[model samples]
Target: MPEPTARVEPDEIRRWLSERAAYYLERPVEELDPGAPLAELGLDSVYALTLCGDVEDRYGLVLEPSAAWDHPTLDALTAHLLAALERG
Candidate 1:
């Protein structure tokens, strides 16, 4: 019998976050924890600000500067992005 495959999100927001976080933290995406706080991953002010810009550019939305803090986890950030994107 063949093994089952896992379902994936089409937007790939989670994948984007994982890759971005990994790049920022100097690690591989596979080593990142989706539910882990980005701050705990060594995300500093510069990283946070750049990430906010990245999100805004990617979604074409106006977001607050503190958005990274508001959505600390990859899951939380992705959920918020999905909701915002759906609204537009």
Candidate 2:
């Protein structure tokens, strides 16, 4: 397993998440809205799972599979991730 990166700010997480979601959606990051539901932007379950894996690998986090469903948006997800990191 890879070591976690340095502590990251919420905006950084949000930007990273937007880029990842954009990649999964096959769109530009600029097209993504932080407040918009990722599912509505076409991030299906498979992508969500992949995203969870990415988060785990990047942040060394053990997240529930339903994390994306629970957070639902880039902003919400970023906040959750930031909180998780801070708790560590």
Candidate 3:
């Protein structure tokens, strides 16, 4: 079996999110606008849910399935994630 990936550090979560978004959106990382809403990107509900699941597992957080919609932008999501981790 493949080794599990290491947990992401709080500070690095933003960058990781950005990269993931870029991947799902099929755009280059530099082409992404961190401030723009993720819904405006090419992401559908399915991808958003998948991303939420990944986030929960990667960060060991108990996040809602609608986390992507609730956070909206990459920056917003990053801040929310950091706060969640801090609270834990």
With a 3 Å backbone cut-off (N, CA, C), the pairs that clash in candidate 3 are none
Q: Pick the candidate with the highest lDDT.
A: 2
**Rank order by TM-score, top first?**
2, 3, 1
TM-score of 3: 0.83
The Cα local distance difference test for each model comes to 0.77, 0.90, 0.80
TM-score of each: 0.82, 0.92, 0.83
Among all windows of 10 consecutive residues in model 2, the one with the lowest summed lDDT is 1-10
lDDT of 3 by residue, 56-82 (tens): 777777678788889998888999987
* Residue pairs in candidate 1 whose N, alpha carbon or C atoms collide under 3 angstroms: none
Report the lDDT tens digits of candidate 2 across residue range 1-88.
3235467878888998999999989999999999999889999999999999999888888889999999999999999999998878
lDDT of 3: 0.80
Greater-lDDT candidate between 1 and 3: 3
Cα error of candidate 1 at position 35, Å? 0.3
**Best to worst by lDDT, what's the order?**
2, 3, 1
> Which structure is stronger by TM-score: 1 or 3?
3
